[model samples]
Target: MAIDRQTVNRVAFLARLKIDDDKIEATEEEFNKILNWVEQLNEVNTDEVEPLSAVNDLPLICREDNVTEGSQADKILANAPMAEYGYFVVPKVVE
Candidate 1:
Protein backbone atom coordinates (compact mmCIF):
# COMPACT_ATOMS: atom_id res chain seq x y z
CA MET A 1 0.00 0.00 0.00
CA ALA A 2 1.17 3.53 -0.79
CA ILE A 3 1.95 5.83 2.14
CA ASP A 4 0.11 9.16 2.27
CA ARG A 5 0.42 12.32 4.43
CA GLN A 6 -2.64 11.29 6.53
CA THR A 7 -1.24 7.75 6.99
CA VAL A 8 2.08 9.20 8.16
CA ASN A 9 0.31 11.55 10.59
CA ARG A 10 -1.80 8.71 12.02
CA VAL A 11 1.21 6.41 12.39
CA ALA A 12 3.23 9.11 14.14
CA PHE A 13 0.36 9.74 16.57
CA LEU A 14 -0.04 6.03 17.33
CA ALA A 15 3.69 5.49 17.78
CA ARG A 16 4.03 8.61 20.05
CA LEU A 17 6.57 10.08 17.59
CA LYS A 18 7.01 13.73 16.65
CA ILE A 19 7.73 14.30 12.95
CA ASP A 20 8.47 17.90 11.98
CA ASP A 21 6.10 19.39 9.38
CA ASP A 22 9.01 19.90 6.93
CA LYS A 23 10.28 16.30 7.42
CA ILE A 24 6.83 14.70 6.98
CA GLU A 25 7.22 14.62 3.19
CA ALA A 26 10.66 13.01 3.43
CA THR A 27 9.42 10.46 6.00
CA GLU A 28 6.40 9.53 3.84
CA GLU A 29 8.65 9.05 0.78
CA GLU A 30 10.97 6.78 2.79
CA PHE A 31 8.00 4.74 4.00
CA ASN A 32 6.67 4.39 0.41
CA LYS A 33 10.11 3.20 -0.79
CA ILE A 34 10.22 0.52 1.95
CA LEU A 35 6.70 -0.69 1.07
CA ASN A 36 7.60 -0.89 -2.65
CA TRP A 37 10.70 -2.96 -1.81
CA VAL A 38 8.57 -5.34 0.30
CA GLU A 39 6.03 -5.64 -2.54
CA GLN A 40 8.86 -6.60 -4.90
CA LEU A 41 10.12 -9.21 -2.41
CA ASN A 42 6.62 -10.77 -2.24
CA GLU A 43 6.79 -11.42 -6.03
CA VAL A 44 9.81 -13.75 -5.61
CA ASN A 45 9.05 -17.54 -5.61
CA THR A 46 10.01 -19.36 -2.37
CA ASP A 47 7.62 -22.28 -2.47
CA GLU A 48 10.38 -24.92 -2.27
CA VAL A 49 12.64 -23.04 0.16
CA GLU A 50 12.84 -24.51 3.66
CA PRO A 51 12.34 -22.32 6.73
CA LEU A 52 15.47 -22.29 8.92
CA SER A 53 16.36 -21.03 12.42
CA ALA A 54 19.75 -20.01 11.01
CA VAL A 55 21.14 -19.33 7.50
CA ASN A 56 24.21 -21.60 7.83
CA ASP A 57 24.02 -25.46 8.29
CA LEU A 58 27.00 -25.72 10.67
CA PRO A 59 26.50 -28.28 13.51
CA LEU A 60 26.31 -26.87 17.07
CA ILE A 61 29.57 -27.43 18.98
CA CYS A 62 28.55 -28.81 22.38
CA ARG A 63 30.32 -30.62 25.25
CA GLU A 64 29.00 -33.84 26.83
CA ASP A 65 26.76 -33.05 29.87
CA ASN A 66 28.47 -35.33 32.41
CA VAL A 67 26.99 -35.26 35.94
CA THR A 68 29.57 -35.70 38.71
CA GLU A 69 30.94 -34.17 41.91
CA GLY A 70 33.49 -31.39 41.23
CA SER A 71 37.17 -32.53 41.26
CA GLN A 72 38.75 -29.05 42.04
CA ALA A 73 38.05 -28.99 45.81
CA ASP A 74 41.75 -29.02 46.75
CA LYS A 75 42.75 -26.38 44.16
CA ILE A 76 39.85 -24.10 45.18
CA LEU A 77 40.42 -24.50 48.98
CA ALA A 78 44.14 -23.80 48.58
CA ASN A 79 43.38 -20.02 48.43
CA ALA A 80 41.11 -20.03 51.51
CA PRO A 81 42.48 -18.86 54.93
CA MET A 82 41.04 -22.09 56.39
CA ALA A 83 39.18 -25.10 54.98
CA GLU A 84 37.53 -28.12 56.61
CA TYR A 85 35.78 -31.23 55.22
CA GLY A 86 36.43 -30.01 51.62
CA TYR A 87 34.65 -26.67 52.28
CA PHE A 88 35.72 -23.01 52.80
CA VAL A 89 35.74 -21.79 56.46
CA VAL A 90 33.76 -18.56 56.71
CA PRO A 91 32.71 -16.71 59.88
CA LYS A 92 29.27 -17.87 61.11
CA VAL A 93 26.74 -15.14 60.30
CA VAL A 94 23.97 -16.40 62.64
CA GLU A 95 24.28 -16.16 66.43
Candidate 2:
Protein backbone atom coordinates (compact mmCIF):
# COMPACT_ATOMS: atom_id res chain seq x y z
CA MET A 1 0.00 0.00 0.00
CA ALA A 2 1.35 3.39 -0.99
CA ILE A 3 0.85 6.02 1.73
CA ASP A 4 0.41 9.60 0.51
CA ARG A 5 1.27 12.92 2.21
CA GLN A 6 -2.28 13.39 3.61
CA THR A 7 -2.45 9.84 5.04
CA VAL A 8 1.00 10.29 6.56
CA ASN A 9 -0.09 13.54 8.23
CA ARG A 10 -3.24 11.86 9.59
CA VAL A 11 -1.19 8.92 10.92
CA ALA A 12 1.23 11.31 12.63
CA PHE A 13 -1.65 13.21 14.21
CA LEU A 14 -3.31 9.99 15.46
CA ALA A 15 -0.02 8.81 16.96
CA ARG A 16 0.55 12.21 18.68
CA LEU A 17 3.80 12.70 16.74
CA LYS A 18 5.08 16.17 15.81
CA ILE A 19 6.41 15.81 12.26
CA ASP A 20 7.60 18.74 10.14
CA ASP A 21 6.24 19.19 6.59
CA ASP A 22 9.61 18.17 5.14
CA LYS A 23 9.70 14.92 7.19
CA ILE A 24 6.18 13.88 6.13
CA GLU A 25 7.33 12.89 2.65
CA ALA A 26 10.11 10.74 4.06
CA THR A 27 7.74 9.23 6.61
CA GLU A 28 5.26 8.35 3.87
CA GLU A 29 8.01 6.67 1.81
CA GLU A 30 9.21 4.70 4.85
CA PHE A 31 5.63 3.60 5.67
CA ASN A 32 5.11 2.46 2.05
CA LYS A 33 8.29 0.37 2.16
CA ILE A 34 7.20 -1.31 5.41
CA LEU A 35 3.72 -2.06 3.98
CA ASN A 36 5.33 -3.48 0.83
CA TRP A 37 7.44 -5.84 2.95
CA VAL A 38 4.33 -7.03 4.83
CA GLU A 39 2.54 -7.56 1.49
CA GLN A 40 5.46 -9.67 0.29
CA LEU A 41 5.15 -11.88 3.38
CA ASN A 42 1.57 -12.77 2.28
CA GLU A 43 3.05 -14.58 -0.78
CA VAL A 44 4.81 -17.23 1.30
CA ASN A 45 3.24 -20.75 1.60
CA THR A 46 3.15 -22.43 5.06
CA ASP A 47 0.66 -25.30 4.77
CA GLU A 48 2.69 -28.00 6.62
CA VAL A 49 4.49 -25.80 9.12
CA GLU A 50 3.55 -26.33 12.77
CA PRO A 51 3.35 -23.34 15.12
CA LEU A 52 6.08 -23.57 17.76
CA SER A 53 6.62 -21.79 21.08
CA ALA A 54 10.39 -22.47 21.23
CA VAL A 55 12.89 -23.91 18.72
CA ASN A 56 14.41 -26.13 21.43
CA ASP A 57 12.21 -28.02 23.88
CA LEU A 58 13.34 -28.86 27.39
CA PRO A 59 11.34 -30.04 30.43
CA LEU A 60 11.21 -27.69 33.39
CA ILE A 61 12.93 -28.83 36.59
CA CYS A 62 10.47 -30.20 39.16
CA ARG A 63 10.54 -29.25 42.83
CA GLU A 64 8.35 -30.26 45.80
CA ASP A 65 6.01 -27.57 47.17
CA ASN A 66 7.21 -26.39 50.60
CA VAL A 67 5.84 -23.61 52.76
CA THR A 68 7.25 -22.32 56.02
CA GLU A 69 6.64 -19.02 57.81
CA GLY A 70 9.60 -16.97 59.01
CA SER A 71 9.65 -14.52 61.94
CA GLN A 72 10.91 -11.10 60.64
CA ALA A 73 8.18 -8.68 61.77
CA ASP A 74 10.59 -6.16 63.40
CA LYS A 75 13.23 -6.50 60.62
CA ILE A 76 10.74 -5.87 57.82
CA LEU A 77 9.03 -2.96 59.67
CA ALA A 78 12.41 -1.28 60.20
CA ASN A 79 12.89 -0.88 56.41
CA ALA A 80 9.59 0.99 55.95
CA PRO A 81 9.67 4.80 55.70
CA MET A 82 6.53 5.11 57.84
CA ALA A 83 5.44 2.01 59.78
CA GLU A 84 3.03 1.97 62.68
CA TYR A 85 2.45 -0.99 65.02
CA GLY A 86 4.15 -3.64 62.85
CA TYR A 87 2.41 -2.30 59.70
CA PHE A 88 3.16 0.17 56.92
CA VAL A 89 1.62 3.67 57.31
CA VAL A 90 0.52 5.73 54.30
CA PRO A 91 -0.91 9.18 53.68
CA LYS A 92 -4.70 9.55 53.74
CA VAL A 93 -6.11 9.74 50.20
CA VAL A 94 -9.89 9.51 50.75
CA GLU A 95 -11.74 12.55 51.99
Candidate 3:
Protein backbone atom coordinates (compact mmCIF):
# COMPACT_ATOMS: atom_id res chain seq x y z
CA MET A 1 0.00 0.00 0.00
CA ALA A 2 1.22 3.47 -0.84
CA ILE A 3 1.28 6.21 1.78
CA ASP A 4 -0.70 9.35 0.94
CA ARG A 5 -0.76 12.84 2.47
CA GLN A 6 -3.69 11.88 4.68
CA THR A 7 -1.81 8.88 6.01
CA VAL A 8 1.22 11.05 6.66
CA ASN A 9 -0.88 13.59 8.51
CA ARG A 10 -2.58 10.88 10.55
CA VAL A 11 0.74 9.25 11.45
CA ALA A 12 2.27 12.58 12.40
CA PHE A 13 -0.71 13.42 14.58
CA LEU A 14 -0.63 10.03 16.30
CA ALA A 15 3.11 10.25 16.86
CA ARG A 16 2.80 13.82 18.28
CA LEU A 17 5.00 15.22 15.51
CA LYS A 18 4.59 18.64 13.91
CA ILE A 19 5.25 18.35 10.18
CA ASP A 20 5.33 21.69 8.34
CA ASP A 21 3.27 22.10 5.18
CA ASP A 22 6.42 22.13 3.03
CA LYS A 23 7.71 18.87 4.60
CA ILE A 24 4.54 16.79 4.28
CA GLU A 25 5.40 15.70 0.73
CA ALA A 26 8.92 14.69 1.75
CA THR A 27 7.58 12.80 4.77
CA GLU A 28 5.03 11.00 2.61
CA GLU A 29 7.69 9.98 0.12
CA GLU A 30 9.93 8.66 2.90
CA PHE A 31 7.05 6.73 4.41
CA ASN A 32 6.23 5.21 1.02
CA LYS A 33 9.85 4.16 0.56
CA ILE A 34 9.88 2.50 4.01
CA LEU A 35 6.61 0.69 3.26
CA ASN A 36 7.93 -0.47 -0.09
CA TRP A 37 11.09 -1.84 1.53
CA VAL A 38 8.99 -3.65 4.14
CA GLU A 39 6.80 -5.06 1.35
CA GLN A 40 9.91 -6.56 -0.28
CA LEU A 41 10.37 -8.72 2.84
CA ASN A 42 7.27 -10.66 1.82
CA GLU A 43 9.09 -11.96 -1.23
CA VAL A 44 11.76 -13.73 0.85
CA ASN A 45 11.37 -17.54 1.18
CA THR A 46 11.13 -18.68 4.81
CA ASP A 47 9.34 -22.00 4.29
CA GLU A 48 12.34 -24.14 5.26
CA VAL A 49 13.53 -21.85 8.06
CA GLU A 50 12.69 -23.02 11.58
CA PRO A 51 11.49 -20.45 14.06
CA LEU A 52 13.96 -20.09 16.97
CA SER A 53 14.16 -17.89 20.05
CA ALA A 54 17.90 -17.41 19.76
CA VAL A 55 20.48 -17.87 17.04
CA ASN A 56 22.84 -19.84 19.31
CA ASP A 57 22.09 -23.47 20.32
CA LEU A 58 23.89 -23.76 23.64
CA PRO A 59 22.91 -26.69 25.90
CA LEU A 60 21.65 -25.60 29.31
CA ILE A 61 23.37 -27.04 32.38
CA CYS A 62 20.92 -29.06 34.44
CA ARG A 63 21.28 -29.38 38.22
CA GLU A 64 19.34 -31.25 40.91
CA ASP A 65 16.89 -28.93 42.69
CA ASN A 66 17.33 -29.22 46.46
CA VAL A 67 16.76 -27.07 49.57
CA THR A 68 20.27 -25.97 50.62
CA GLU A 69 19.66 -22.48 52.07
CA GLY A 70 19.14 -23.11 55.80
CA SER A 71 20.89 -22.95 59.17
CA GLN A 72 21.54 -19.20 58.84
CA ALA A 73 18.76 -17.72 60.97
CA ASP A 74 21.13 -16.31 63.60
CA LYS A 75 23.46 -14.89 60.90
CA ILE A 76 20.63 -13.26 59.03
CA LEU A 77 18.70 -12.04 62.10
CA ALA A 78 21.76 -10.23 63.38
CA ASN A 79 21.05 -7.36 60.99
CA ALA A 80 17.43 -6.88 62.14
CA PRO A 81 16.58 -4.31 64.80
CA MET A 82 14.12 -6.79 66.34
CA ALA A 83 13.90 -10.53 65.52
CA GLU A 84 11.65 -12.37 67.96
CA TYR A 85 10.36 -14.93 65.40
CA GLY A 86 13.45 -15.36 63.21
CA TYR A 87 12.33 -12.70 60.73
CA PHE A 88 12.86 -9.06 59.91
CA VAL A 89 10.94 -6.81 62.31
CA VAL A 90 9.32 -3.76 60.76
CA PRO A 91 6.92 -1.09 62.03
CA LYS A 92 3.26 -2.05 61.86
CA VAL A 93 1.89 -0.42 58.71
CA VAL A 94 -1.83 -0.97 59.35
CA GLU A 95 -3.95 1.26 61.55
Candidate 4:
Protein backbone atom coordinates (compact mmCIF):
# COMPACT_ATOMS: atom_id res chain seq x y z
CA MET A 1 0.00 0.00 0.00
CA ALA A 2 1.32 3.42 -1.02
CA ILE A 3 1.22 5.89 1.90
CA ASP A 4 0.39 9.46 0.90
CA ARG A 5 2.02 12.71 2.18
CA GLN A 6 -1.17 13.58 4.19
CA THR A 7 -1.22 10.15 5.81
CA VAL A 8 2.48 10.56 6.70
CA ASN A 9 1.73 13.99 8.22
CA ARG A 10 -1.21 12.59 10.22
CA VAL A 11 0.93 9.66 11.43
CA ALA A 12 3.68 12.10 12.47
CA PHE A 13 1.11 14.18 14.38
CA LEU A 14 -0.27 11.12 16.15
CA ALA A 15 3.24 9.92 17.09
CA ARG A 16 4.26 13.44 18.33
CA LEU A 17 7.01 13.80 15.72
CA LYS A 18 7.99 17.08 14.10
CA ILE A 19 8.74 16.40 10.40
CA ASP A 20 10.01 19.34 8.32
CA ASP A 21 8.18 20.20 5.09
CA ASP A 22 11.18 19.06 3.01
CA LYS A 23 11.37 15.73 4.90
CA ILE A 24 7.67 14.91 4.30
CA GLU A 25 8.41 13.40 0.86
CA ALA A 26 11.22 11.22 2.28
CA THR A 27 9.08 10.24 5.28
CA GLU A 28 6.17 9.27 3.02
CA GLU A 29 8.47 7.14 0.86
CA GLU A 30 9.87 5.35 3.96
CA PHE A 31 6.35 4.79 5.35
CA ASN A 32 5.15 3.32 2.04
CA LYS A 33 8.21 1.00 1.96
CA ILE A 34 7.39 -0.21 5.47
CA LEU A 35 3.73 -0.78 4.54
CA ASN A 36 4.75 -2.69 1.41
CA TRP A 37 7.10 -4.88 3.49
CA VAL A 38 4.26 -5.59 5.96
CA GLU A 39 1.94 -6.41 3.01
CA GLN A 40 4.57 -8.82 1.71
CA LEU A 41 4.64 -10.56 5.13
CA ASN A 42 0.87 -11.20 4.76
CA GLU A 43 1.60 -13.67 1.95
CA VAL A 44 3.61 -15.96 4.25
CA ASN A 45 1.88 -19.26 5.32
CA THR A 46 2.13 -20.01 9.09
CA ASP A 47 -0.69 -22.59 9.32
CA GLU A 48 1.50 -25.32 10.85
CA VAL A 49 3.42 -22.98 13.17
CA GLU A 50 2.77 -22.96 16.92
CA PRO A 51 2.71 -19.77 18.98
CA LEU A 52 5.52 -19.57 21.57
CA SER A 53 5.62 -17.41 24.70
CA ALA A 54 9.43 -17.58 25.07
CA VAL A 55 12.23 -18.26 22.63
CA ASN A 56 14.26 -20.32 25.12
CA ASP A 57 12.90 -23.77 26.18
CA LEU A 58 15.10 -23.97 29.31
CA PRO A 59 13.47 -23.78 32.78
CA LEU A 60 14.26 -20.68 34.88
CA ILE A 61 16.66 -21.29 37.79
CA CYS A 62 15.44 -19.92 41.13
CA ARG A 63 17.23 -19.53 44.49
CA GLU A 64 15.75 -20.27 47.93
CA ASP A 65 13.92 -17.18 49.39
CA ASN A 66 15.61 -17.13 52.82
CA VAL A 67 17.46 -14.44 54.80
CA THR A 68 21.18 -15.25 55.07
CA GLU A 69 22.13 -12.39 57.43
CA GLY A 70 20.73 -10.87 60.65
CA SER A 71 19.27 -7.31 60.90
CA GLN A 72 21.79 -4.37 60.63
CA ALA A 73 19.54 -1.34 61.28
CA ASP A 74 22.40 1.01 62.34
CA LYS A 75 24.52 0.09 59.26
CA ILE A 76 21.55 0.65 56.95
CA LEU A 77 20.68 4.06 58.48
CA ALA A 78 24.35 5.22 58.60
CA ASN A 79 24.17 6.91 55.11
CA ALA A 80 20.79 8.60 55.74
CA PRO A 81 20.81 12.42 55.80
CA MET A 82 17.91 12.37 58.26
CA ALA A 83 16.72 9.21 60.11
CA GLU A 84 14.24 9.12 63.02
CA TYR A 85 13.43 6.04 65.11
CA GLY A 86 15.01 3.51 62.66
CA TYR A 87 13.29 5.13 59.63
CA PHE A 88 14.14 7.73 56.97
CA VAL A 89 12.79 11.21 57.74
CA VAL A 90 11.68 13.34 54.79
CA PRO A 91 10.00 16.74 54.52
CA LYS A 92 6.23 16.47 54.88
CA VAL A 93 4.43 17.33 51.60
CA VAL A 94 0.79 17.20 52.77
CA GLU A 95 -0.62 20.43 54.18
- lDDT string, candidate 3, 1-95, tens digits: 88999999999999999999999999999998999989997898989988778788999888789886889989989878888877788889798
Local distance difference test values of all predictions, in order: 0.92, 0.86, 0.90, 0.90
Worst 10 residues of 3 by lDDT: 79-88
Which candidate has the highest lDDT of all?
A: 1
TM-score of each: 0.46, 0.46, 0.48, 0.47
Best by TM-score: 3
Residues 12-87 of candidate 1 have per-residue lDDT tens digits of: 9999999999999999999999999889977878899877698888999987888775788899899899899998
Predicted structure 4: lDDT:
0.90
Candidate 4 local lDDT, 46-68, one digit each (tens): 89889878999999999899988
lDDT (Cα, tens digit) per residue for candidate 2, span 1-95: 77999998888889999999888888888999999989987787878878778877988788778766558888888878999888889998698
What lDDT score goes with residue 76 in model 1? 85
Clashes of each: 0, 0, 0, 0
* Per-candidate RMSD, Å: 13.6, 8.4, 11.7, 8.5
- For TM-score, candidate 1 versus 4, the one ahead is 4
Model 1 ranges off by over 4 Å: 45-95
Model 3: residues with Cα > 4 Å off, grouped in runs: 46-95
The TM-score measured for candidate 1 stands at: 0.46
Ranking by lDDT: 1, 3, 4, 2
Which residue pairs show collisions in model 1? Answer: none
